[model samples]
Target: MSRTIKHEEKYQQFTIELDGDEAELAYACPSEDVVDFTHTYVPKSERGNGMAESLIEEGLKYAREHNLKVKATCPAVAKYINAHPEYKDLLAHP
Candidate 1:
């Protein structure tokens, strides 16, 4: 299925619309330069299709473009960044 990830600034989430269903990765900015990824949700029908990964990748790209550090509060996002070492530099430091 074709999918497009979009940043909803008012909601602070990256979302994908598929077949009229929505999957989103939510985040919060706790500081000027840091964005904390708080949650990810994909409907059961949309699961196992890598939609969440696409949302995370879009979020990461947003962070990079904005020059913001990322804090992966969501377990899946943390794991994704761990597996994709190239994204490690985007991690926020305490």
Candidate 2:
């Protein structure tokens, strides 16, 4: 048997940096206990580095710390939750 193939991560690694120039990722909240996860958009130049995930994670972390809930309307946010069910409870009310 002979098989050779390269393996790589399908997505970028999530990370957040509070630099003066780093994009804020457009985190938004329309109301209390509600976070609009989809509004955030990382620049194309910054794509494929999990930067979006980092931003979402950071925002959610903030909400958790502040005892606030989240409404993952953003596709990225929902994808993250899909990858991490621990955050399923954060999904917005039906």
Candidate 3:
């Protein structure tokens, strides 16, 4: 199923509401042009449904649009970046 992801800048997270529960990918901006993906959470019922991938994609897209490099501190986000080489260029230098 297609889901609508919402970026809540105030909360520094991307979220999707599913079956009245919310799945979120939280992030932090430590520098002017860097976005650090800090955590990802999917409701138990929402797991295995690509909710985390969707949030990661949206978060990366947002960072790209705003010309921000990415730092994937969250394991899920790091795994996604590793699996998707297309997004590797967006990673911030270590």
TM-score of every prediction relative to native: 0.94, 0.65, 0.95
Worst 10 residues of 1 by lDDT: 13-22
Worst 10 residues of 2 by lDDT: 1-10
TM-score for predicted model 2 compared with the true structure: 0.65
Question: Which pairs, if any, clash in model 2?
Answer: 38-74
lDDT of 2 by residue, 15-86 (tens): 333333343334455686665654556556666766666667776676677676777766777778899887
Residue 25's lDDT in candidate 1: 99
Per-residue alpha-carbon lDDT of candidate 1 for residues 7-80, written as tens digits (9 for 90 to 100): 99999999887678789999999999999999999999989989989899999999999999999999999999
Select the stronger candidate by lDDT from 2 and 3. 3
Question: What is the descending lDDT order?
Answer: 3, 1, 2
Per-residue CA lDDT of candidate 3, range 1-94, in tens? Answer: 8989999999999999877789999999999999999999998887998889999999999998999999999999999999999999999998
Candidate with better lDDT, 1 vs 2: 1
For candidate 2, give the lDDT: 0.58
Q: Could you say which candidate leads in TM-score?
A: 3
Give the poorly placed runs of model 3, Cα more than 4 Å off.
none
Candidate numbers sorted by TM-score from highest down:
3, 1, 2
- Where does model 2 exceed 4 Å of error? 1-22
